[model samples]
Target: MKSIDTEKINVGVVGLGLMGTSLIVSLLIAGHKVKAIAPIPEDMEDAPQRIREHLMICEDAGTLDRPVDCYLSQLVISEDYLLLAPCDLVLECVIEIPEIKRSVYKKVEAIISTDAILASNTSAIPISELQKGLFAPQRFLGIHWAEPSYFTRFMEITCGAQTDAVLAEWVYELAHQWGKEPTLLRKDIRGFVTNRLMYAVYREGLSIVAKGDATFEDVDKAFRYDVGSWITLMGIFRRLDYLGLKDAFETYNRLAPHFCNDEQIPPLMQNMVEKNAKGTRNCLGLYSYTPDEAKRWDEAFAAFNVDIYRLAAMYPSQREKKKTRV
Candidate 1:
């Protein structure tokens, strides 16, 4: 119920996969004492090495102030849930399965202090659904982080119906301290805001490809050269307001497809998943590309973020106005 002093807070990340590791390094970079946990003993053993690699990347990107080892020393990796007892905030980033998440939360509840806030990094599951059956559900919420979390400034903070307002505000303030532009969702909503808008674009993009209306390259190029650059700075809604809301609404009504229903997953996407073309992980998707190509795409995305941040910094009034409107 009280605001957390992030500098003094003990943070625990309860998964050692990509997301969990990213959170660990980002929290450490922000000067928080981090306790990182993994389910497997091997994962615990690899944590230090992974942390070092992440720090090296940060150094290469010119984002680190101290030596990697000095930062690594602040992170404590373990396989036992009991090690998280002292943490004031525990972020769960396990597999997306509801049962797995619930099991992790139950374990965390048994170990962490009574007032410790519980958060999930789930992108789709509702926070309320995840908090179901918990004795102190008000402390449970979602702190969804975008992929490559350490590099992305986008963060969505959602609170369940039972979540305390004071705690939500505390988390919002804490996220700002951690160098994230965190947006608080006043109520639990499916996909929150970012994903709701993003997935709408994604679903339509896939539909376009499925209907043979555009090639993958064409769609990528359209976003990259067109709306992508603008959205990076002013987001969709702000850009709409900037361009005149009436004009934006007219365009949306004119171009929005009426038949892009969610009744079925596109055959192309289904086939890709069925064929084990799991995207960057497997180096396959709507279009085939090498691992290096994927890396290039990632670097481009990071560069875009940095450029937008710099531009936004120059226009502080616009950024402040957007915050005020929110």
Candidate 2:
């Protein structure tokens, strides 16, 4: 009913992990008042410090002119759901478990206003399935964000079958105000857009290494040097268009059946998990890393996100041309 453009509506975030905290910082930077719920004593204890670190990152990037405390003043980390009754939008960012997310939605729906739009930052779950057993399914949609939400300009607003189209548009415009390159998906689908494409790459890359066709570094080297050079500017289809080559079509015909399309989890990844090789968080994953190197990679990626976000802003992705009938 009201204009979302240039509006500073109250927003509520249900989780306080890295993604949730990063999202809260992004909202604060976009001039919205936010109520964030960490839901656990440990998370609540760390939320303030985590947010302060991000605020300082923004300060150094020259995006936020005010001191960290100035933005901190706008955020409320609360344990109560009643505090969220006034929000215009509420996003659930719980872990990727269905039961945990369903319980959160039920609790959040009970206290919020009927008109408040409910959204999920779910990367893999289907919004249509998540809307089951909700009183007002029309208000629920998926608002998937790329990690380090404060830095990444990408946002996906996906609408389930029951979602209200008008509410989805309001959120779409709001994402633009927050400095995001937002997309609206009219239909709900698993993994939405980005995750689906990215996971395909993951599956193929892992298969290559597991089959001993290449080492982890070799795969990374090829991707970084080849795909990396133009991915930030244009996607694969556009690159193919510019090159006047359809080499991939013939290559795919030869390789389609050979590609890994197994329904079961790869033994490679399962063994890694069984061994507790959990990547930088645990200092080992697909590739081995010393503790110090792991820490450096983590910090370096965070730093790179800030600058890469700026560069992405400078050259945002373009929408594809719609094919017209002859």
Candidate 3:
């Protein structure tokens, strides 16, 4: 992949909610000029303030180099779509509704330059489905960023059937330039890579709890203590290869029955959704917690991610490369 000329590139992020705010922070820290756009009038007022907050959090955690104010100066927030014309890359992070996404994309397509790459942050929508009504489908793709996009380096770059390969490759390279560890999806698949693997585990986990095989805490403990640490460094495939592929596959085939089958949605999850019990936001879901408790959980999640990134940075090859680059 060819390197993006960081000095010449301007990134525009649409949607100033949690994910969009995080992306702006990441781009600012990577030394890129960023323009953030939000539909709500209040977001135009709060974008820079929120960006400053994120920078302060990073600085407090010792992950950033300078003051929050310094980074805030690099971000520009606008309510008009025309302000995005100068952006070389525009990432759409609106809510997951199809009509809402399409409406936003239409506005973005009108304002952005013909050469600008348009990407969606949708987790569940297929890239092809999103590209269907677009005039220039080749310039559009999916950039699946995990939650809290600032600190987490994993980025999945997926392309629709109509997406240009060269453009996809350019986006992949640009992600690295912005300090992301990006993986390219050669073909668009439902749920993408990370979600597919995670949902498989989640299905079984929910099933286990539903069947009274184990409590939620017990199931979480099995993964948190055993698989979590190892999987951080080595992925599932690599870990299996290290353990001898033949033996691993044989064991999986035999023990697979003990795991949950491809069954209907667990009753508990359906009930929660029906009641509008959306985890911490609604203060009730699989677990119940107060607003303060939810805030603590968010902090713990951020800190855990920070530690994971630090460990990833410590890879032997990465260490040597850092020295050589210096």
Candidate 4:
């Protein structure tokens, strides 16, 4: 088996949903050869076009330096699992079903080299649970990526009970090459870090609305205007420090008891799910939208992502600091 080369490695992605194709673009941009496996027939038919469109968006956003074809040429999309034989790393972005994921893992493991790493892009599944039955459980881990992988700098590299620490560290470092600010979670936990934090906010937001303290629109405005203002520049902890720890301490003490602690799913969300509401995708959501309104919201979000991607680059997490006086 060939050794893993951070500069020019062969990476394979199994599953070709929107996130999978977007991730292929990120890998290609990072100068790696990518093999994408479309497990479902529908994805197989749509993967190539979806990839092309994402690359085109990158070009328009001025994120793609070379001709789009240059990157696309380095990708191979197929149903053949054998093509993954040369991959140094393979990440599965399939459904969150454990059975389906385990089956894909079995197939990929049968073809790839022993040294090759296998990972999943599961958002909420515990990495420890997913690695339970894998042939080489030590090599299996979780590498969660935010949507629009090429644009977002968010990534989380998680370790299961049997994960090789050294291998996970290598991936954590390599994630920087893919333009991510990756967090390494040495211990596995359900919902990982991002989901836990975001879901807490979601629960509180939903509860507030359900209790008549605020409407959905009111919560959305507060989140967008307040949290959205400084969240990009500084995360929760840092913002607390930036504002003043004393104020945060006092607020937390006063508000802790009143915050939502409901263990059950929020009724508003449950109702929406029961109605098959997919937000902007189907013009049905917390707030109703006409078909054209939904389309506009969808387009606006894509454009916003591009703008924010560029803006965030200006204040990167690793920005070099100026020397201070002794």
**Cα lDDT tens digits for candidate 1, 1-326:** 55456668899999898788877888988888898889767787776787788778778877788998888888888888999999999999988999988988889999998899999999889998988898689999999887566676678899988888788888987887777788999799988997787778778888888788998899999988888668666777788778888987887788766548675777877888899897776788777779999888777876866556556556444436667999
Model 3 C-alpha lDDT versus the unseen true structure: 0.84
For TM-score, the strongest prediction is 4
Comparing 3 with 4 on TM-score, the higher-scoring candidate is: 4
Q: How do all the candidates rank in terms of lDDT, highest first?
A: 4, 2, 3, 1
lDDT for every model? 0.83, 0.86, 0.84, 0.90
Once superposed on the true structure, which residue ranges of model 3 sit more than 4 Å away at CA? Answer: 1-3, 290-292, 316-326
> Per-residue CA lDDT of candidate 2, range 25-127, in tens?
8899888889888777788899889989988888888888677888789888889988898898999998999999999998899999999999999987899
Q: Distance from true position, residue 114, model 1, in Å?
A: 1.2
Candidate 3 global TM-score: 0.91
lDDT by residue for model 4 (237-286), tens: 98998998998999999999999999999999999999999888788899
Error in Å for residue 48 of model 1: 0.9
**All candidates: CA RMSD in angstroms?**
2.6, 3.0, 3.0, 2.7
Pairs with backbone N, CA or C atoms under 3 Å apart (clashes), candidate 1? none
- Model 1, residue 53: C-alpha shift (Å): 1.1
**After superposition, which runs of candidate 1 have C-alpha atoms over 4 Å from their true positions?**
1-4, 256-259, 291-326
- List candidate 4 segments past 4 Å from native: 1-7, 319-326
Model 1, CA-based lDDT: 0.83
Candidate 1 weakest lDDT stretch, 10 residues: 310-319
